[model samples]
Target: MMTTVVWLRRDLRLIDNPALYHAARRGPVIPLYILDEQEDMGGASCWWLHHSLRALQGQFQSFDCPLILRRGDALSILQELIRDSGADALYWNRLYEPRTIQRDREVKTTLQAEGLEVKTFNSSLLNEPWEVQTGQGGPYKVFTPYWRQAGGQITAKQTLPVRDLGSQDRETASDDLRDWALLPAKPDWSGGLAWRWTPGEKGALDRFDRFLEQRLQLYADKRDFPAVGAISGLSPHLHFGEISVRDIWNRLGHFEDVAGVETSVAKFRSELGWREFSSHLLYHFPEIPEKPFRSQFSVFPWQEDEALLTRWQQGRTGYPFVDAGMRELWQTGFMHNRVRMVVASFLTKNLLIPWQKGAEWFRDTLVDADLASNSASWQWVAGCGADAAPYFRIFNPVTQGQKFDPQGKYIRKWVPELRDLDGDEIHTPWKVAKERTGNYPDPVVDLSVSRERALAAYKSIK
Candidate 1:
């Protein structure tokens, strides 16, 4: 009689999933996913979700619990399911996105009013956004203190090995995956995406293992280099909650054989801390997605050029490094973290476009696009966010490309038009012979002139 409904969201993995674990304790469980328009999973993300859900469905099937997929209002569907199944309890892991928070709170209130046993737990963040705060009882805006506080307070709990939940029968109809239209149609642009990523719990674990075995040792030193291939590339995994940060944290400490285990662990944890910081920032300042955190930036002159934005999106900005990053993003639904900053800087600074515009584009393209992370990062690059890099430190694209993708291998891979150009010539193809440059476009704007323009704009605002 104690059937429980487990509402699944970003936390797709079954292991160490507090919601799934607790729900499994209460007799038979009805696992569910309800997709709605509120969370606009863009083209690339949708493709990943389709595959990830398929993988997740298989996992649930092995446990004899079908992950019922429904496309509509979550509240209405859950209520109907509850009525039909007579489920007495409901549980879910927390989501911190502002709109999602409001939606969940309303859902919880409505469900609790209906006399259901409702409970929510932290399965997403190592430290829940509210849990980590300042001495004055406020959220920490700066990262270092927040990181120190969070790291000191956080500990990984043991994962739930298995749950002995039995099968549940429900007459409620579920939507077919294909009907959801969570994939591209007409042309299927996800071909490159398919070749690059594997998006599920198993995939997350495998990627994490690879990162640990190969890249973790040099992650601190080489992570900023686009060509280094030292990063974990686990953003999409973390975004979808295929693996928990705590799981990642625990595994990060398993580098005893490496010489600089402590150093590497610290560096990697700092990166995770930055993720936590983004979540924390979003929780406190919900306006990050739309408004600049720094108030003065509200009046900053921004170019509203769709044509320029199109060029930027299509990797024809003619700045080889920026182009490579944009192309990589377009092709694989990911860009190296360093190149992300460089391209973002190029957009919000050099081009003087609104950060929100770039943020929107990323939201539509990135498989790993979490609202908080995307907004926070774009604003940081634009110097309009909390604890952002100073505006004066504009990234020189050619120098950045030369420094990071020094041998231009990363550039060559993504921007093949300049692939034949030797060394640094790959970073500035416009400077190369027209025949050698092939069809690569000229730089959209003079780098030095644009830098000065951006600086002047910043100075005027300041």
Candidate 2:
């Protein structure tokens, strides 16, 4: 029987995985995962990776195939693996990160040159970034048009059911995953993460099923409330490709006649669209991660206050909602979507901290730290990206907390210091009597003054 090698990356699942599925069609397959160091992979993501890979290894074992783990240059590993296993063909799902795209292209060229049939399939996105375009034959800079055009071209359809990669006799050695040092060892910071998520294909499906059955109906109404927790919590799963967009899309169902269900489903689909738009933005404008998409913001003044930044990072920013969000991110490796925007606004607008710095912090801390989404989102909140939020629409932390976490459940859960404050005092502890206030820090910056300062700064750039 022919031997084929399947390279795994973000696409980690057995079900709905195009690469492993197609490879199984031809003959016996070897599954391999390479820890590519060149990518901007961060610690929490690395922590997630270790567990997810461990889960995936179990998945492959159930199929009677072993997953080979390697750490180093992917091309070098692939070449060595091919020679070692006598594998004549290789398959993998595609990655859209700019550097990854470049690396994969070069690897594909070399593999084809060596007479090894290399096939790559799209398993991550609803539509490949390149497939969608505007009327001007250029990439879309605006989200609505991009979504409309792209949405029309793609359908929620999954391919044939999985046929496992049957056992192969060839023995291939793989590096021990523990030796890679991907997880935190001394002073382990991942205990909270362990509590929050299960790491592989099974986990992704479990989370999706839980959301679809219980939460999808009320998602539209409840998602904005930080206390209610209507989120699918699937970002890291989507980023790692433990589940495919199409699979989730199809599972949400066509629900055409159902009123409330349709609204919630549509909202969720739009979120998926935003994710697609982020990838599309990254594809068309490669510099989005490094530079402002709107060039005028290059000269915009940003604060260089390390002390304040430390406060922000440590979730002592003196604003309950922002602090709660930051603390939640630090402890759980995730944050609520609405609160994320509030924190981003607080950093970039109110404090005048650079968006890049906040983005980097999120990258290191968040399990769902996707470069495309993180970078685009930071820019979006900073009002310096394509179709970005208006600069003057600064979020007042006090009002935001009062509005979303009206009962203070979310704030109390994450920021424990302010737990006893009752009513609106939880949102603005400084407003209450000094004796009633515990040790919660004072407001970092006066809201009105900061708003004026931010607006004036924006005007200078304009």
Worst 10 residues of 2 by lDDT: 251-260
Q: Write model 2 residue lDDT over 1-462, tens digit each, in one string.
A: 788899999998888888888899999999999998877778899999999999998888888788999999999999999998899999999988789889999999999999999999999889999999888789999899999898789876755477968787767898999998889988899999999989888899899989888888879899999778688999999999898888888877756348778989888999999999999999889999989999999999998899989999999988889999999998999999999999999999999999999999999999999989998999999999988999989988888888888989999998787788886778888887767656778888999999999999999989
Deviation (Å) of 53 in candidate 1 = 0.8
* Clash-forming residue pairs, model 2: none
lDDT of 1 by residue, 172-252 (tens): 567888888888989878888999899999999999999888888888888899788899989999999899887888777
Candidate 2: residue 47 Cα off by (Å)? 0.8
RMSD of model 1 against the true structure? 1.2
Q: Once superposed on the true structure, which residue ranges of model 2 sit more than 4 Å away at CA?
A: 254-256
